[model samples]
Target chain A: MRDVAIVSTAQMTNVRREQRRNEVEMLMPVVQEAVKRSGIPKGDIGFTCSGSCDYLAGQPFAFVSALDAIGAWPPISESHVEMDGAWALYEAWVKIQTGQADSALVYSFGKSSMGDVPDVLNLQLDPYYLSPLGIDSISLAALQARAFLEKTQYTERDLAKVAVRSRKSAKDNPNAQLAGDFDLEKLLAEPYLVSPLRVHDCAPISDGAVAVVLAADDTARNACERPAWITGIDHRIEPHQPGVRDLSESPSTALAGAKAGVASGGIEVAELYAPFTHQELILRDALGLDASTSINPSGGALAANAIMVAGLTRIAEVANRIQWGSIGRGLAHATSGPCLQQNLVCVLEAK
Target chain B: MASGDGGLLSASHIVEYPYRRSTGPVMGRFFAALRDRRFEGVKTARGRVLVPPTEYDPQTGEAADEMVPVGPGGVVTTWAWVSHPRAKHPLNHPFAWALIQLDGADTAMLHAVDTGVESAMQTGMRVTPRWRAQTVGSINDVACFEPEGTS
Candidate 1:
């Protein structure tokens, strides 16, 4: 496989809402900044790919309009996915591996504030059974959290600690939507949003976008001082129906982690895309991450979940830290679907 | 901090797909049985019965054509108490969204349990389907599940 490295990354400061600017307008600056930092001209970008959900936009083919942000004046070769931007990055990586492109641009955008976000996600469920029942997203996660709690020794307090630590970590992240030195006692005292899960346990519905540039071999060496080289990347999926699989454990994540060579070396940091507090614990165990590994130093999805973009942000977060020469190697994870149904694991190392 | 000179304009935009979709063969069998106040499942090659059955085996792509009767009563494999129901929820008052493993079925089905009190819900609680008076050949034909001993 060709050596692909993430040369640059940029993202908008996550907020509760971005009502004035449309999706395209919100993504334009981020995409420009990422390319600028890479020192790769727009014309030189071999391919462009994005991840976004039209359901969030409340329109059909909404992603088509987002292409305007990348400047289609010359009609560049680009593709889009109905998933998180991490999957888009995967597609661009494949394009480069096949000798189709030497460099690629990857971006994702989402505005959960556009409508009732949880309810909007309900539309993605199986129409025959789950969807007709009007099962919103949080309640589904609550079910998973309850199952995880009953099967393990983890309690509500343990879940609260995860929340407190994440928010504290977010304090250093300027782009995070929720960040502060939260009191653990005060947090545990909060009421449940949906039984097992408190509001703090859930990722805040956020609006934002993220963009990252990828260059292969010589292109990567010339673009940045230190490129976070992609040593291994793989994604796996489980049965779509939640009942068929074990909710307490994430076999798919573990399988992907193994394929991505997560445990082959000592990982200094890990950016996990767990939207709920208990899910972080689940992914951590699945990926075999020890207590010594720093998890979600950028606050993770729990601080600012920009729907289609948060997964990609996780990858960018770890890459940014690696690019700065702070860490030698790290793992980044992205999850899609309810109860960790689909997962992608990517391992990055400093060059 | 200062307020912006111009405030943003907004309007309500309803997002919906207004279309009639067929439930298809496998799902149609399950829903049609619901209309008759009965539960049906499909038998897989592994001899496992799947409730709210799919046309093909989940693990393999093999077609599953045998329809078998499942249950009007089942044990809750897992549950989450919906302390406050949303406007779009099946029930107005508090309920638990549970995955009920019906008798003779290998997989559980997702539905609402109208247990009123959150304390009344538990993982292994026995529940029965409460069907709507007017059945529409849809999953909602069974309004919600209720505690087995309850009226």
Candidate 2:
């Protein structure tokens, strides 16, 4: 595959609710920033791809308005994914690999706070079986958390620890909506919002936008001093039915990680987009990351869980670390559907 | 074009769905606050406050527990004139949608503006919320933003 690296990443401050602005208003700045930072004019971007959910905005063709954010009067070649922006980036990377485009831009946005986020997420479940049950996102996650606790040695306290650590790490992130030091014991003391999962164990309803710019080797070298080279990128999907798959193990993520060559040189940092705490642990085991590697230095989805944009933010966070020369090798993972039914893994490096 | 059996079976399916959402406790509180003619934001662990409060903080990824009153007025950070409005937009007439940073809040809130004069709506224009007479538990509770000096 041809060498492609993320040259610029920009995102709106993740918030609980973006009431004053629509998705287009929220995305314009991030898109402008990404292109401006890359030193590439908007017209120069050979391809554009975006990730978003029609359900979140309560409208079909939600992505069409977002095009206004890009000022597509001239009509640039563009496509969109019903998945996360990481998958969009992967598609852009493929476009570069095929020698179709030397540079590409990927973006994602969501207003999860527009309605009941958990209830809205329930729409992602199987329409025939699970949707009829009306099992919302948090309730389903609680089921997974309970199963993980029953199957593994991890405890509720362990889950709280993840919340505490993630919140503390979020202190440095200006765009993070949640962060701070919290007593794990105190968090545990709070009544359970969903039995096995406390309120802290669940991600908050959030609204935000993000954009990333990708360039082939020649463009990458000219744009940034230390481009985060995307060495391998791959994604996989599992059967949508939750009953058929092993919820405890994300076989799809593991498979994608292997396809992306995540274990090739040992990942120094990993950005796993697990909105729930237990999902983080499941992803950790699936990606084969140990305590030695730094996880979620940007506080992760638990910090700023903006649905469609959260997974894309993971790729940007890991790439930022490489761009800043903080890590040598990193793995960025993004997921969609219920119970991690779909996953994308991207291996980034600095050379 | 002809089919093997000398007959063509051509069909097209057009599906339209309207979603009904139940505003849960947090969002319910937010809309309730709006109905009361007050702007509220959820306070995050980092101490930065966001308007139309997020149920969770974007930084810590934790649920926002504290509700803080933000603003009825603030400065317009950035705006774009909506010369052509979409079907579902709050306003059917031509207007400018702006990102207004409400007073006492760290971030901006998006809403439509009724300044009438598109040329006057700049990044730093001061504006105030124009609330709807009939308040529903939705973002449309605030009809739009109007230039502070106009009314």
Candidate 3:
């Protein structure tokens, strides 16, 4: 595989809603910022890809409308996925590896505030069996949390601690929606929003966008002085039906981590896209992350999850840290589907 | 869609697939059984039965053959309490969404248990289907689950 590094990354998040801007308007500035930071001309970008959910937009081919932000007047090579931006980054990485594109642009956006967030997620369930049941995202995740608690040693308090730490970490992140020191006892005293899961355990429904620029080999060296080289990246999926798979253990995450070589080196920072507090523990165990690793230093998904963009934000977080001269090596994880059903892991190193 | 500032067009639209689709072989039998107030599962090559039967085995991807009667009664494998019911929820009262492992079935099926209170629900609780008086060969044919001994 060619040495591909994320040359530049930019994002805007942690806001409850972006009422004024459409997806294109929200993404345009981030795109311009990322491309400018890379010092790469917009036209020099060999490929462009975006990730967003049409369900959230409530329109067919909704992503096509987002193309206006990138200015496709000259007709640039582009593709899209009905998934998170991390998956879009994966596609761009594969394109570069295939020698089809040397440098690429990836961006994703989500506006969960437009509609009933939990109810909207029900549309992604199994139409025949699950959807008819009207099992929304929070309820399904609550079920997972309950099952996780029953099987593991963790408790609601442990989950609360994860929430507390996440928000505390977000205090410095101006882009974080939920931040500041939370009282543990007060948090525990809060009533459950859905049985085992309290409001704090769940991610804030957020609206935002993220853009990343990737350059391979010499293009990478020229674009940034300290590049966060992509050492390993892989994603894996499990059976789609939640009942058929074990919800407590993320075998898919473990598989993706193994393929991404997460355990091969010492990780200085880790950004995990765990929307729920309990899920962070599951992903941590799956990826073999220990206490030594700085987990979710940017507050993670729990602090400012923006649906489709949160996963890509995980990658951008680690890459940004590497570029800032704080982290030598890192691992980033992104998950999709219910109960950590599909997972992607990427390992980054400073060079 | 709300009207936006300037000339940019905005309109509210409800995106939905207002259409009917065939359930196909295995699921056809499963729903047909539901119409008769019965429960059935597809027996896979491994002899394990999967409720909400798929035409192909989930584990093997081989064609599923035997349609075996599984359960009108099952035990909750795991559950989460729904304190405030949504309009779309099966029951208006508080209930538990459970993964039920019916007798003779290897895999679990998701459904709502109308427990009325959170304390009434628990893992391994016995529950049975409460069928709709008028069945239409749909998942809602079983209105929801209720405590096994309750009327």
Candidate 4:
């Protein structure tokens, strides 16, 4: 694959609600910041890819409105994913790998606070069987948590510990919505919102946007002092049925991790988009992370779960770490569907 | 819904979408079962029988065939108390959404549990389906699962 690196990353603060501005308004600043930070003119971006869901906006073709934020006057090459912006970055990286584009601009945005997020996610299910039953996202996740508890030794407290650590980590993240240290024991004591899962186990609803700029070798060198190069990128999807698959583990995630070479070349830090606390535990085991790896240094989804944007934020956090010379090797993960049915993994390295 | 800001004028507007789907035998059967006011579960390749059955075995990716009745009653695997329901939800009033694993089925089905008393609902609670007065070829046919003892 041709060398491509993330030269710059920027995001709007994750908030429970952004009633003042729509998605286009929320995305404009983020796109400008990414281009400005990359030190590249808007014209230099050879391609653009974005991640977003029409369901989140409660309207179809939501990404079409986002084109205004990019100022596609000349009509730049572009594509979009119903997944997350990180997946868009993966597409951009693939375009660069094909030797088609020297640089690419990727972004994602969502206003999940506009409606019931869990209910909207039900649309992602198998329409005939799952949708007819009206099973929303949170309930599906709770079923997974229950299955995990029954099969594994992990407890509700373990899930609470993940939340506590994630929120504490978010304390340093300006874009994070939910942060600050909390007593894990107290969190466990809270009544179950869904048995085996407390309120803290779930990510707070957030509305936000994020953007990242990718450039080839020379372009990257000119754009930033230290660029986070895309070493490996891969994604996979599993069956959609909740009952058919094992909820205790994320096979798709493990498959993506293996294909992305996460285990081959040790990673210094990892950012995983686990919207549910129990999912973080499932992902950690799937990704093969041990104590040495710093997971979610940027607070992760638990700190700022912006639906479509959270996964891209994980990529941005890892890229920023490399841009600042904080870490040499990093792994970033994004998930979609109920109970981690689909996963994307990207490995980054500073060059 | 808001009007698009037409910053750039174009002579023509084009729209495209794809809705091609293969509702395999199982989901086809489930939809057919719904039309008949009956639910079916096919024993998967993995030995777990699922209701509103899946078309393909999740493990082996093979076509699932054995059809069995998932009786009305089941144990709630997990549930969320929905204080504010959405537009497409089965009921407008507050309801407990649950993953209920019916007897004879290894996998669970999601539905609204109608315990008029919200406090009465809990995870692992026993509930039975309250079929709609009129059956439709959709999940809404089962209006909601009511607490076993409640009318």
- Best by the lDDT measure: 1
CA lDDT for candidate 1: 0.92
The backbone clash count of each candidate, in order, is 0, 19, 2, 0
Residues A276-343 of candidate 2: C-alpha lDDT, one tens digit per residue: 89999999999899988889989998899897899989999988889888898998889888767789
- Pick by TM-score: 2 or 3, better one: 3
Off by over 4 Å in 1: B1-11
**Model 4 ranges with Cα > 4 A deviation:** B1-25, B42-50, B60-107, B112-130, B144-151
Candidate 3 error regions (>4 Å): B1-12
Q: 2 or 4, which is superior by lDDT?
A: 4
Interface C-alpha root-mean-square deviation of candidate 4: 3.7
Residue B70 displacement in candidate 4 (angstroms) = 5.8
Residues A91-162, candidate 3, lDDT per residue (tens digit)? 999999999998999999998898888988898787888999788899999989999999999999999999
lDDT of each: 0.92, 0.81, 0.91, 0.84
Better of 2 and 3 by DockQ: 3
Candidate 1: docking tier: medium
By TM-score, how accurate is candidate 1?
Answer: 0.97
* lDDT score of residue B18 within candidate 3: 92
Residue-level lDDT tens digits of model 1 in B52-109: 7998988887899899999989999889988889999999998999999998899999
Measured with C-alpha atoms, the lDDT of residue A238 in candidate 4 is: 86
List the candidates ranked by lDDT, beginning with the highest.
1, 3, 4, 2
Candidate 2: CAPRI quality band: incorrect
